[model samples]
Target: MILLLGGTTEAKEVACCLEAAGMPYIYSTRTEVKFEGKGVSRFGALNKEGLECFCFTNRISCIINACHPFAHELHHTVAAASLNIPKIRYERGFPERAQHELVHYIKDYSEALAWTENSGFTSMLALSGVQSIPHLRSFWQKHRCWFRILDRQYSKDFASRHSFPADYLLFGLPQEKEEEVTLFQKLNPDLILTKESGLNGKLDSKIEAAIACHIPILVIEKPELPRAYKLVHSQQELLHLFQHE
Candidate 1:
């Protein structure tokens, strides 16, 4: 059995592949969003006893980890558990957009904010997820901004405590064209901030929205992690990996 540490669009695609290939596996989730493929075993956040139960009840051999990079807790604990189960982190690569000379690369969001301070963007949108709240709240609070977040409001409240405006955005992904267009119009943003979360982090629509609205973008590049295998942007390659396994 495979324990798929799922929470991204790529997780669903992987599930599709698993079903098509006729494999049985478990899909773990903390949110209400249902995975695409059926016949998946379900589990939520596993406690210590729960982990013991999981280890005892199943012959789980491989873990298909699809959680985001910033989700260090999930990756560290579940992905690094003491079992015979080998883990393959579905890594996220960079987007294919052409880099202009104007686009700057920084280590993380704090540096990104430092670079932007007083330089003045027409407007800014933060899509780095909640992990980026410290940099945004502490430094980039004065800018015209919007932030997409889950229901927890972790990032939003943090930003609020640090004097960020209360009227910022709280949203989700894979938006349609009209929705993107609507956001583009509503924000009238000139700069878009995002992370490099590859295929699973489905921000393609948002990118299209920004480009369609002629807005420039800022990206928080993905930080490299150990023991993670990156899948090339082709299924043939993925199949080759599976075959070698």
Candidate 2:
């Protein structure tokens, strides 16, 4: 049986392909969401040993790693466990370089916050998720920053627990470029903070709005993946691997 580590859009597409091909596999997710896909599924996380054990016990012939690009720790776990197995690292590629001059790419949240502090951006709009809120405590305390987060219970509870200003917590993801522009105008932020989520992240729309409003963007670059793993860019490539092996 194949083990498909899924969560992203590419993973869903791969799932559809697998279902169509009548492939026997198991889908794994880190979070507890309603998975409307086929095949058996296992929820929650696993350590390196646990992952290897699962692979061995379930007889996972191959692994399709379709987790979020930002999930670096999970990637490492997958890499370590799949050393002796056929593993496919599926990733949605990010741009080689930022197109706009105003786009300042930083290493992580801390550096992004530091950039904001150094740039004197008092009012900042953070498109990065709630997980990053804790790291930006000092920045939030100092500046009038608003966080755009998902409208989920855990998100709300975490924000509340962290003492993030209720009014400053904007729910829902940005949809279109025009919506982003409207949001930018409404916020009137001096700078915007976001992560490099690549094409799947709606990065272009946010960048377009930032460019239109003349607001500088502080982008936290994606984390590095493991070196010794077979990597694929698209669903087609992943499907090809499954077919061949």
Candidate 3:
């Protein structure tokens, strides 16, 4: 059985490929999602011991990791657990449009905050999501910050629990460059903060808006994942890997 750690779009594609190939597999996600794949699926996180037990019990022959790029901890856990079993990392290709002069890339959130402190920026609109709120809290106390979170009950609850001011929160991801431009005009922010979520996260729209407003945008670079048996950047490569391996 193949153990497919799936959550991203690539994961869904991989599941579809596996189904068509008539390959026995188990799909797993960190959280419960509305999965349409007609195969065995499991929800919830698994520690090293738990993963090892699952691999052993299910006779897992291979592991295909198709998780979010910024899922650092999960990546380490998966790499550690796949020492004996063959593992392939299905990563999304970086968006070609991310290359530009106005876009400043930083190593991590801490660096982003440090740079913000030195840059003399007063107000910022963060498109980096809810996970960034805690790190930006101190920065927020000193300057104006608007955190855009998903329009979901869980996201709202999490933000509320963190005591993020209701007024400082913006819901929903911007679907178009014009929508982002409208936000920039209304906020008149000194800076825009985001993560390198690649093309899938619609980072281009954010960049376009920032450029239109002549605002500098700071991006937290995606962390490197551990080297696996195979690393594939597209669905075709992933499917080809399964065929050869």
Candidate 4:
């Protein structure tokens, strides 16, 4: 049996591939998001030791890691736990960095926040998600900022727990370029912030909207994955691994 670590859209793609191949697997997620795809669904965060125990108890022979690129800690935990098993990293294809004058790419959250502080952006729109609320607390506390989060109670409660202004939270995902432009016009923020979440994350739309509104945008680049796992970019590539087995 395979243990599939999933959370991103790529995870669902991986699950679909597995189902098509008639493979038995367990899809694990850190959150309680609905998984309509075929697989035995499980949810909860697990540490390295816990992961090893679960793998052993479940008779997991292979591991498919279709997690978000920025899930750095979980990547390490999976690598550590899958010492004697085959681990596959189903990575998403990222677009080339936008070279527009309004596009500024930062290394990570800390640096992104540092740039925001020194850049004199009075009002900002954050497309980075709910988890970033605490990371950018210093800037939001002092400036006029808004965060776009999932329209779920869990996300709202998370922002509330972080003491972020309820009124400042914008729900839902990134929209088409035209809709995004309308939102940008309405918000009229001094700056826009987002992550390098690839095509599935609708990064292009966000950048286009920011450019249309003549607003400077900051992009937090995706972090590097662990060298321990084998990486594949497509469903065919992932399924090909099991062809000889």
Candidate 5:
């Protein structure tokens, strides 16, 4: 049996493939985002102890990590938990490095905030999600900047605590290229801030949005992990690894 600690589409696909292959497996997700399959389990918060319990309970041998980037702590915990259990990470291909000559790439959020403020970006769109809000709040409060987030994910106090103007667009985005262009036209933002959540999270929409808006994007780079096996964007490679073993 295989234990998959996952929350992405890729993870769901892998779980489906494993099930079709007649392999027993369990899929773990922090949210109730439904995946079509039999015998798939969901966990609101997955931790090391829970992982061990699941593995032992099911007599599973291998652990698959389908979590996206910024799940650094989860990655380490999984690695440490598996002394005898083999672990595999289902990673999509990295983003194509399309260098924007006008855009500046920062090492982390702090650097991105500092550079955006120092660069005199009077108005900015904080599409880095609610997670990036705290870091940017200080500058926004002092600068009287503008930003937006999903109304479903955050509270009314979210903007109040941060001292930024709160307005809920509640706009549902389409995944088409032309639709992205239309959304970009609607936003008319001067700048966009986002993370490198690989290609799974409608990332192409963001890049296309930035292009259509003719604005610069501040992408937070992923860190180099320690003592890890890496792959270069190949599902066939992943298939081979799982199939041969």
Candidate 6:
């Protein structure tokens, strides 16, 4: 049996590839999501110990990691747990950093907050997701900021627990460039904040919208993955791994 850690679109593609190849696997996600793949679906976050125990009990032969790039804790846990198992990381292709004068690439959330503070960007629009609310709490609490997150009850509950103002919350993902332009115009923020989530994350639309509106945008770079796991960027590369196994 194989263990597939998934939650991203790339994960769905990998599941499809696995199915086409007639491979048997168990697909796992941190939370319950709507999945229509053939693999046995399981949900819940797992620690290093739990992962190892599960793999052992299920007779897992290989592990495919197709999680989001910013899933830092889960990536670390997977790296630490499956030392003996062959682990393959299905990575997303990140675009080259934009060289526009209005675009700034930040290393992480801490540095992003500092940049905003030093630059006197009080009113901002954040497209970095609900999980970032706590990370940037220091900046938002002292200034005017709006966060765009999934229009789900869980996301709202998360914001509530963090004491984030409900009125400042925007629901749903960024639309087309024209719609995004309208959003920027309506909000009229001092700056725009987003992650280096690659094309799949609609980074280009955000960049274009910011540029069209002449709003400076701060992009948080994706975190580096552990060197222990082998990385494959396409479905073909991921499927190739099983051939040798």
Q: Which lDDT tens digits does candidate 2 get at residues 83-183?
A: 48787887886756667888888899878877877877788899988888898999888879899998888899999999999999999976678999999
**On residues 66-113, what C-alpha lDDT tens digit does candidate 1 reach at each position?**
777666667656544666555676655556854554344457777677
Which residue pairs in candidate 1 collide?
A: none
- lDDT value, candidate 2, whole model: 0.84
Where is model 5 poorest over a 10-residue stretch in terms of lDDT?
A: 167-176
lDDT of 5 by residue, 86-182 (tens): 6777776566755765455678878877877677776666656555667876676655444445454443456566655655322242255677667
**Which has the greatest TM-score?**
4
* lDDT digits (tens) for residues 125-180 of candidate 6: 99999999999999889999999998878889999999999999999976878999
* TM-score of each candidate structure, all chains considered together: 0.72, 0.93, 0.91, 0.97, 0.81, 0.96
Evaluation by lDDT, superior candidate among 1 and 3: 3
Ranking by lDDT: 6, 4, 3, 2, 5, 1
Ordered by TM-score, highest first, the candidates read 4, 6, 2, 3, 5, 1
lDDT (Cα atoms) of all candidates against the true structure: 0.65, 0.84, 0.85, 0.90, 0.66, 0.91
Over 4 Å off in model 3, which ranges?
Answer: 97-101
Q: Whole-model lDDT for model 6 versus the true structure?
A: 0.91
Prediction RMSDs, each to the true structure: 4.2, 1.7, 1.9, 1.2, 3.3, 1.2
Clashes of 1: 0
What TM-score should be assigned to candidate 2? 0.93
User: How big is the positional error of residue 165 in model 4, measured in Å on the Cα after superposition?
Assistant: 0.8
Error of 6 at 143 (Å): 1.9
Alpha-carbon runs more than 4 Å astray in model 4? none
- Error at 114, model 5, angstroms: 0.6
Clashing residue pairs, backbone N/CA/C < 3 A, model 5: none
Candidate 6 off by > 4 Å: none
lDDT of 5 at 71: 75
